[model samples]
Target: MIELTLIGIGTGNPDHITMQAARAMNAANLILIPRKGEAKSDLVDLRRDICAQVLAATVRIVEFDMPVRDAGGDYAQGVQAWHDAIAAVWREEIARHLPAGGKLALLVWGDPSLYDSTLRIAERLPGVKVSVVAGITSIQALTAAHAIPLNPLAGSVVITTGRRLRAHGWPPGADTVVVMLDGGCAFEALDPAGVSIWWGAYLGMEHQALESGPLARMAPLIAGRRARLRARHGWIMDVYLMRKEPSNG
Candidate 1:
């Protein structure tokens, strides 16, 4: 039986890796890392760094080129096709490296339970026993960096993707909203008045940047900063939390 473990490494910080994740890495017989093109080489580098820091014994590390999703096609269909292609690549690599079936691992950016699709991709492989080692999420990292809690006491928080946020307005009955996987600053579509925002980029890494204030005041600033950072680094991963301002009473 093939034991596949998906370990969350957190938001690009070596220290963000938990002890459980470290043990899982060291225990794995092989680890697979994905190369997301030259523009986002930092992602591969970060995974390499994590392996270097955690794997104490000899373990096979295989690097595979990731498939790009077709953006021109229907969104859902494009993503499904892309995932199928990636699964094919994974199967080939696993057969080549561990034909007899052994323990394998993949490092995920954040907790698998979140918006990440590593778990979904793993489902494509048959008869592979899977395990997950949770690590810090970008949300937790962002909230910590800003020194704020996720929600007010007894208040609710909604976690949604940028695509959903743009498609649907502020979720009905949502006390606070946390948006992720947004290439564009989707918050600009909403009325900034009565809303406060806390945003962070490259969160937890050395080049990390943060900005927070009334949404009206910070939306444009964040958009500009996000553009600049992406241009400079060739890629950017960011998250933001927004909530209606407390009643002045």
Candidate 2:
């Protein structure tokens, strides 16, 4: 049986890795790092850097090209097909490297439990014993970087994806919302009058950028900045928190 360990390495910063994650990296017989092509080459480089910093000399590193989803098809169906393709790739790579079966690890960006699909993909590998090493999430980094609590005093916060926010609009009774995986500026769809936004890109990295202000005032600036950064870096990961004015309710 192959022992699969999903180690969360936090955002793009090497220092974000926990001791437990480091230990898992060092102990693994092989580590699989996915190449997301030139557009997101930095992602693969970050995984390599983590291995370089944490893995033992004897630990083997394997690289594989990741499958891209079919953007033309229905969103869910495209994602499902893409995930199956990835599972097939993983199986082939594992069989090629460790024909007899052995311990393997994958360094995940941010915590796997939060908006990550590594666990779901692992489930497709029947009889594979899965282990998880939790690390800081982008949400944690975003909140900490802003020095703000995730929710108002004793209030609840809804964590959601950008698509959901765009489709459903602001959720009912949720004073604060944290949005992730938003390729588009979904916030522009909402009435920005009473809402405030705290946005960050490349959190926990040297190239980190942050902006906070009334949604109406800062929405355009964030959009402009996001476009420029994405053009410059070839890719970008960002998250934002939006809160309605407490007194307005």
Question: After superposing candidate 2, which stretches have Cα over 4 Å from the reference?
Answer: none
Best model per lDDT? 1
Model 1: CA > 4 A from native: 247-249
Candidate 1: residue 28 lDDT (0-100): 88
The lDDT values for all models are: 0.93, 0.93
RMSD to true structure for each model, in Å: 1.0, 1.0
Query: How far does residue 48 in candidate 1 sit from its true spot (Å)?
Result: 0.8
1-249 per-residue lDDT for model 2 (tens digits): 899999999998999998899888888889999999899998988888877887665898989999988999699998889999999999999999988989999889999899999999998999899999998999999999999989998787999999999999999999899999999999999999899999999998889999999999999999999999999999999999999988733
TM-score between candidate 1 and the true structure: 0.98
